[model samples]
Target: MFRSLWFDGRLRAVLAQVLIACGFAGVVGWLFWNARHNLMQRGIAMGFDFLGEAARFPISEHLLAYQPTDSYGRAFAVGLANTLYISLLVIVVSTVLGFLLALARRSRHPLVAAAATVYLEAIRNTPLVVQLLFWYSVVTLNLPAPRQALEPLPGVFLSVRGLFFPSVSWTGDLVPLAWAAGAAVVLLGARFVYKRRHRAAGARGWPWLALAAGLLLWGAWQGQVGLQSQAPVLRGLNFLGGASFTPEFSALLLGLTLYSAAFSGEIIRSGIAAVPRGQWEAARSLGLRPWTTLRWVVVPQALRIIVPPMTSQYLSIIKNTTLALAVGYPDLSFVITTTINQTGQAIEGIAILMAVYLSISLSVSLFMNLYNRRINRTQRP
Candidate 1:
């Protein structure tokens, strides 16, 4: 039996793979040991113990409350929150802008198509870092100061400081507001499930939107959710009261959105083009309007083709957020850099950064893959 196993091609292949794996593991172990030994000889501790120590650094733009006295872990969390906030904003805004750009390019009008083509070419050809620097300069140098801010709307101000807009403040019982939000989620979930169950009929989005709006109104009437919009006012040297986007954040977001939108538009346009011409003809023959046909027939089918490539685009967007440091936006990478400089725990800091990014990329891939499967299954006969 042993002689036969050794001679078998399949068994030999398995043995080869096992040996390669063991060799790779051994090399990794040796490298890790060598690094640790070197660090010890230099009288430097190599571990995650630095994470518990006080960061003693200030993060200029953080979603979470943080202080210099906060632990390194808390500082990391703040930085992570900022990174996620910008990334999500870029993803959402870029996707919508991209879809619109795609539609514009596909438009029969010569002028519209030409304009979109020019925009796409300009953005796609230029380096993103250069574009970011340009935006940063524009925001910080070209824009007027707070006292002379541009008021594009009733409650919006644009200035060197940032974009300030009226923001809603909820001033009511938290429990009822939570209940209302939960109910809205359940309604949306039910709509999703119903569409999944009945693929042919699918779902109409307006009904769900109306339901959520009605819930909000009902909550307002019952005093369960009291929302007041606070507008920014010039106070001292800056705008105060309403929510504001720092100049760094505004420039970074704008740069990312415009840069990514170009690629996303091309991806969407290609997907739309990939849809069989017969499908469009069939919808038109059924007396459906062009917009209706695109919405009900083409876009849904195009989504299957669009999703996979779009996943890579999204991952790119997440990774590109590391450039936020260039414009002084305090993203995770920025925090990591500061942490390394202050704590001198370069290895641990870098390891943490790698793990965070890897986890995020994997999560995005997993979600997109599942969505892709669902779309494929839905279209299957």
Candidate 2:
């Protein structure tokens, strides 16, 4: 029986894979044991007990509320929030900028095409770190000080410290805002379902949009909610009473958006190019306008090619947010570094950082893959 099993190709393959997996697990176990033993010998502790301890470090900018007395876990959460906020902004801005760049490059106008080409070449050839540093210098060294800040628009101030603009706040009941948000979400969901079911009719979501707006207006009126806009005013040496973007954050956003957009533009351009010329001819024969053809036909077909590489580009941008450290922006990795320095729990801190990044990357990939599959399904007969 043993001889026969060894002769069976399928059985042999299974046995070989099992052996490989076992060997890998064994090696990993040994490495862990060795590391633990060494650490014990040096009296270094393990585990995550430090999470509840106060993290005295300061975070410059965060979406979530944070204080110096907050626990290490809270500080990490703040860092993760900052990372996500910047990454989300970069992804959105880059995608739009990239689409424009791709279109300009494909334009028949010589000057437009040349300008796009020049921008792409220059951006793509340089290291992203250098671009980030250069932008940092422009914001920090070249910009005017707060006392002599430039007012580019009403209630907008640009200075070495940062860009400050008016922020709107709803001074009213929270219940109305919650109801309005819920109504908007429901309307959007219904619109999505309508689009999927009636693909041929090309249903517009304007009605849904209008309904959501009406609901919001009604809610605001009932709740007596009023929007209060607070503009920044020069206060002594700095600006006060408005939302502001720090110099570091502004530099990081500008650098990441421009840098990622160049690559995204190239990827989009290639995908568009990959579509057969016959597709364009077919679109033209249908008497469709150029913009309509590109929008409805060419782009949808090109998406099959675009999505895979674009997923990678997005993942890269997420990871690149770590470069925030160079500009002193307190992203997840930055927080991890500080945690390690303060607590000497290098292993735990690094593990948390890796896990957070891995989770984010996987989530993004899964979403894009689903989107890719949907497009692929639509293309099938």
Using TM-score as the measure, which candidate wins? 2
Deviation in angstroms for 352 in model 2? 0.7
lDDT tens string, model 1, 221-336?
66656778888989899989989999999999999999999999999999999999999999999999999999999999999999999999999999999999889999999999
lDDT of 2 by residue, 40-139 (tens): 8988888899999999978888889999999999999999999999999999999999999999999999999999999999999999999999999999
lDDT of 1 at 19: 100
Q: Note the Cα lDDT for every prediction shown.
A: 0.93, 0.93
Q: Superposing every Cα of model 2 onto the true structure, what RMSD results?
A: 2.7
Task: Show where candidate 2 strays beyond 4 Å.
Answer: 183-218, 378-381
TM-score for each candidate, following the candidate numbering: 0.90, 0.91
Worst 10 residues of 2 by lDDT: 196-205
